[model samples]
Target: MVDKADKTAKVAPAKVKGGKKTSPAEFIRQVQTEGRKVVWPTWPETVRISIFVFIMMIILSLFFLGVDSAFGAVVSWLLTLA
Candidate 1:
């Protein structure tokens, strides 16, 4: 009655010791290699993303304001009942 999926899930991956540890000097070299792969956004792309982010921020601010006002109204009404 055991499912194949359940059986496979019980088996764990083998653990290795000390095979993947990198020296501090080697780590810095790896970091520099990765740093070279980064390409910065063009000025136009940066401007577009900045505008998009600004619009989203304004939208989220309005949404939170409305939500807070609704909660405040509910709380004020409940307080009046007491």
Candidate 2:
């Protein structure tokens, strides 16, 4: 029979490649190197996307408001019949 305590015990972390841990300074250097490789969008592209998002938000809010008003009117009429 297996021991319940062994099943509940914490497992050790797996060893790194070549059993070497990365130093904090080396990690930061690697992060900066990766950051330099990132591509950023132009200002015009950012503005265009922002405008599109704002327009879609306004359109969706108007659509939901119309639907909610219609439903509210129907509920109010049904309550009047009771």
Best by TM-score: 1
Candidate 1 residue lDDT tens string, 1-82:
9988987786665544555667789889989999999999999999999999999999999999999999999999999999
Report lDDT (Cα) of residue 65, candidate 1: 100
Name the weakest run of 10 consecutive residues (lDDT summed) in model 1.
10-19
Q: What is the TM-score of each candidate against the true structure?
A: 0.71, 0.63
In model 2, the clashing pairs are: none
True-structure Cα RMSD, model 1: 3.8
Clashing pairs in 1: none
lDDT of model 1 at residue 37? 100
TM-score of 1: 0.71
lDDT by residue for model 2 over 7-82, one digit each (tens)? Answer: 9999989887778998999889999999999999899999999999999999999999999999999999999999
For each candidate, the alpha-carbon lDDT, in order, equals: 0.92, 0.96
